[model samples]
Target: MNDYLKNGLFLAAGVAIGALGAVALGKGKFSIRPAMADLLSHGMDLKEKTATVLERAKENLDDLMAEAKHAKESREGKSVAEGETA
Candidate 1:
């Protein structure tokens, strides 16, 4: 009987502590001003635009590399022909 009473009291104390902790750690309200919201949206748009520019730059770089490779092959072929003639 005494053991049961002690156990019940412990359980009640644990429940009360948990409830208090939950209330203290709950999230509060959040609000953003209209000007700040517009700024944030504009920033996101700029990031998307920058990403598109970088993608185009990467494609241009690839094309340049292909052209350079072709040019190098042509130069090597010419050098080989000159060597044979010599």
Candidate 2:
């Protein structure tokens, strides 16, 4: 009924068809195992890279949040310092 729903269903069907086609083609001339194995062998590298990226993101976020908190406190502290009770 909805345009978004219809479009989503169409996109899903297209992805399903493409996946089926890849599997069918793999059965003949393409070997999915070796490729997947190569990727799997790099699993550690992927994991380490992902962890490093996440750690850096978390550290940056923490630093930013701390700075934001300090700024907020400074703004609020000004009012208290000026003899205003809020």
Candidate 3:
């Protein structure tokens, strides 16, 4: 019985708020379009920043891999020369 009463009150409150929002929207006193646009603008900015950071990270990784490969080849060539001399 107590739970039912609580649920009923919550439902009533929701209906009241919905009705008020509808009235406000009908009168053009409140708008969600501008807010949505701002949200989307921020989202776009974040996406661009993330893409740039990822590209930079990929370039850095490529440079490190090239350096490592060169170091390995140099070591192998030195060992082969030393073996030939022996």
Candidate 4:
């Protein structure tokens, strides 16, 4: 086929597809506002839940770190006492 003919055919196909899509969309009562609002609402809820989970994890990690530090200090104290006896 000729290049010009191929280009024309593609252009016609694109127009036909666009026209059909527009007609289909026009026939439906598809409101994007409500869909977007619902999505944002869910996103906010997820954000809140994630923040809560992260906060709890931070608290648990802090407690674990404190306990580890105290354990290390206790071990050091025991080693010093043993050294003094020797």
Ranking by TM-score: 4, 3, 1, 2
Taking all chains together, each candidate's TM-score versus the true structure is: 0.55, 0.54, 0.62, 0.64
lDDT of each: 0.87, 0.89, 0.93, 0.92
Q: Which order, best to worst by lDDT?
A: 3, 4, 2, 1
- Write candidate 4's Cα lDDT for 4-78 as tens digits: 999999999999987986876788866556766898899999999999999999999999999999999999999
Off by over 4 Å in 4: 1-30
On residues 12-82, what C-alpha lDDT tens digit does candidate 3 reach at each position? Answer: 99999889867877899668778769988999999999999999999999999999999999999999999
Cα RMSD, model 3: 10.9
Candidate 2's error at 78, in angstroms? Answer: 0.5
The best candidate by lDDT is 3
* Stretches of model 1 off by over 4 angstroms after superposition: 1-32
| Candidate closer to the true structure by lDDT (higher is better), 1 or 2 | 2
Off by over 4 Å in 2: 1-36, 84-86
Q: All candidates: CA RMSD in angstroms?
A: 17.1, 5.4, 10.9, 13.2
